[model samples]
Target chain A: MHTRTIEILVGLFLIAGVVAALALAINVSGLTGSNNGSYKVYAHFENIGGLTKKAEVTLAGVQIGTVTQISIDADLLVAKVEMEIFSEVNYLSIDSSVQILTAGLLGGKYIGLSVGAEDEVLVEGSIIEDSQSALVLEELIGKFLFDKVSE
Target chain B: MNISNKIMDGIASMGRGLLDNLAGLGRASMVLVHALFVWPQPKTSFSLVVKQLYNVGVKSLLIIVVSGLFIGMVLGLQGYTILVDFGSEQSVGQMVALSLVRELAPVVTALLFAGRAGSALTAEIGLMKATEQLASLEMIGVDPLRRIVAPRLWAGFISMPILSMIFAIVGVYGGALVSIEWLGVFSGSYWSVMQGAVDFYDDILNGVIKAVVFGFAITWIAVYQGLESVPTSEGISQSTTRTVVYSSLIILALDFVLTALMFGDV
Candidate 1:
């Protein structure tokens, strides 16, 4: 029984360690912004590969905000991605574009927003005119492999 | 019989055995369900859980920690070798972190725990049955399932994630150390790449959830096999072997399922 008590205490510490790790992982991104009232915007994509709710959403090569939600729009037949951008970042002009881009070959995809030279800023509810979906690397690899075989 | 006939007979016998085991599994599930409802009071069950926690968690820590260090070092070495091909050897940190958090840490830690704590749980319970201790408990109005099995289950479920986290942390550190000192990568650049590669919550939650599922599978199979032990010593030994094998198989299967559910959205 005495040995059992010691073991149980050790077990609790193990659990605590796991919980600590998870907490650190969740809060560790280290990307924080000044208190700017950033408005919400939604982007529609066919597929946002491996992009989870807390994924980073960037504009003009700079991370502006994070993905707030990802849901399927039944009426529109598309993936609706909601993102929150800081209000102070003024680079998102009217003609700016959003593209789902990969970090590297096997890394997670993030929304990459490129700025347009337009003078007017995109207001809330204004959709970015042009967007590109993620390129499925596996599919591309398969195509290349098959093409080589056929050739 | 001739060779072909003998082979066919063996296959048929194996199939029959599998079917019989499936039927037995169904019966065991029923027994488990019955045991759950008729279990003893909450206080006793809690104590059982406490006892299990000690056995599974505390006793397993040192092994988990040492395992973590070696896994980390290997991951670092392997990742550096590949990254060097692309002149991106500094990316070893990220590679080590991703590999450990995403796959190796959870799997290795679970395997270790299953081989150690899981086998022990099965053997102990099997021995109890073989010695009629389980029956004796019942005779004294003690509900063995709630007291003995439930705690072990809870202990396993709790310990797996904890052990996995320790493994990942240690592994990443080990990888970084090897990459810097042995591989001669610039420490600053290596760490920077790792810093960029890992996002705290996104990467960390993946391991935690995987560990929890692993814990549940290891304990459940171990305790279940143990509780179902026959009276003979041979029966007890057989159950112990089965518990270890089945627990490992279940762990791998669960890893696939969880990975698909969690990361397959891409």
Candidate 2:
């Protein structure tokens, strides 16, 4: 009887470890976005440079949302990115810049939000005005080569 | 003349000792093969395996978790210090996750298992031998090898991977705590960077395979030492010490080989 009790306890401990590992895996994978008190926003860019769905959206280094969708504009040949911004970050102005940025030198792409001096706060379903795409390494290299060749 | 004779004698004894140890290993392997393949009763082996699993895996949980956490914290702190100079502190997540999943988790988990459970198993078996319990079992026509050693060996094989997984997972969290909360990194960055950087097959699955291999080495060494140890108190102590030393050396060496094979091209 005593050994059986001990076995049960050990089994419970092992189960807890597994559950914690699973929870951590899910959290780190970013499967569940910032669903806590968030609203939608959108932006347009020339090139996203391998940005995928569910990329983080940050305002002043704080995560405020995620990129929910990416689509190409039919006429302007621009990438239209849809974002979900949490309502807690309500201080963003209508003219705030939305820029695609790499987290580190070779890290994943995310959205960086820069504040503007305008007084009117951004509303739901609004578009950020100043949008910047990621800097493409190949484009820069090609441009450098073209300049060098011309010279 | 006397001094030369002593030197010659010492060399001769050393050779004899080496031969004796090799012979012991041969006998132990025979026992292992029988224990593993020649199943007498499946129910008894299964129950014994569970008991050994509890002893080796569950009892060592606290130490594994604590060490895993500290290892991760150190990785985060040190990684940040180095990476911030390059303006890449954000990549600490990748550094920590990759380090833990690919190398530290399996290596550290096996080391701890050897030190704690491996040493204990060795001592326990050595004690049983010293007390002549094994002889008694043999006289009773019971195959002590199957009854005693096999389940423990199989248990270690199973436990090492699970423990290493838990270690890596816990270590990642420890890294996140330091990188995110203490260092003021974005929480999202801590996890997202890791998820993007680590591959399921290359980083995680390979780490698991390494864990299984380390487990087999450690357990086999411990059990072999215990069973073959000279039937004395000094012998038991010596075997226990040898188990720790040999298992650790084997774990580190195997890590290098596995890493070369798994990630040599990349």
Candidate 3:
């Protein structure tokens, strides 16, 4: 092969590798440019247990949105979570119940949605009623210990 | 000889063969390191290395792209089913990214590199030796190690990591295409969840490091096996096959060792 051709080939190879690496690195970590067609919903919990921002909100085991914000209700002294559900899921009923459920034995916490028997549809910024707090492992262990001690 | 004597003789020969393999491993490692020290001693080495970079890295692009896309798509589909059970199918990006960066990219790229570039290197050097071209160069006082082996070895060492990274990057895009476009996942959740979970230094850098190490090991075996083989057509062919076999085994074993050291809890 000619020296010039070899140089061009090497340059192309290097460029391809660099671009791919950059793409891969970008894909793995940093700000997600995934803000496409998502709308917000609200749910309140008494104890969120290790739940943080960007958790999942699902209906019937299917992901419909993300937990975009978390804050405190000053009067209720409880946690409030804001979710960004996709616009396509237009019929999440207002009477739907949200629960803070853990995945597997040691997986992350997410909000699970179960639709209630109601004809009303939830528009943007609507609040989900009948939400439950996260099932804290520490609390479960403590309660178990107390029950054993008393027995 | 009696049956008992024959059994004893078989055991003795096995022990001797084991010793020979150990000795060969020691000798091959020494020669590889020696070539590394002599790598920069030649004026013509740069152009040759570039040629090898094109030969190995550029030529392998299509294979890498095709396989990377398929691997990513498969992971996305499979991970969706499992993650859906956990109500976290949106995190399919995390599953694909972590799996590709930490394992599949390096290991698969290295295996392919061995079969493509590594086998060819062995065949090329073996042919040159079989035809007495190496002997002619040595007769004129030109060192074959500097002229022939060093450039190819170094080129492979550099190219492996780059190819692996490209595979990983392309793979992530493939996964995104499947999970987001095909499966109707929320587009934003895919990339963002991946970003939230994967670590840069812990996962990506370690994968690149593994590729570089695998490159050095595979290329060293290829070049050494070819350069030192008996100067015959059959001998050359046998050594080329051995290059692929040995590189595959060593790549897998070294991956285990490196993973234990780099990602182990200790």
Best by DockQ: 3
Per-residue accuracy of model 3 over B7-88 as CA lDDT, tens digit each? 9999999999999999988988877777778737455777778888888888888898899999999999999988888777
Q: Please give the range of 10 consecutive residues that has the lowest summed lDDT in model 2 chain B.
A: B188-197
Q: Using Cα atoms with residue i matched to residue i, what is each candidate's TM-score against the true structure?
A: 0.66, 0.75, 0.74
lDDT of 1 by residue, B91-155 (tens): 68778888888888888899899998999999998898888888899999977776677667767
What does candidate 2's lDDT look like per residue over B143-238, in tens digits?
788889988998899888888888898888899899899998777667767776776667777988999999999999999999988889999999
Ranking by lDDT: 3, 2, 1
Off by over 4 Å in 2: A20-25, A28-100, A104-151, B1-25
Clashing pairs in 2: none
Clashing pairs in 1: A7-B54, A8-B54, A25-B200, A25-B201, A26-B200, A26-B201, A50-B266, B72-B171
Candidate rank order under TM-score: 2, 3, 1
Any runs in candidate 1 off by more than 4 Å, and if so which? Answer: A1-8, A11-151, B1-19, B31-40, B181-192, B199-202
lDDT of 3 by residue, A3-32 (tens): 798799889889888877777666575544
DockQ of 2: 0.23
In candidate 3, the residue pairs with backbone N, CA or C atoms under 3 Å apart (3 or more residues apart, or in different chains) clash, namely A34-B188
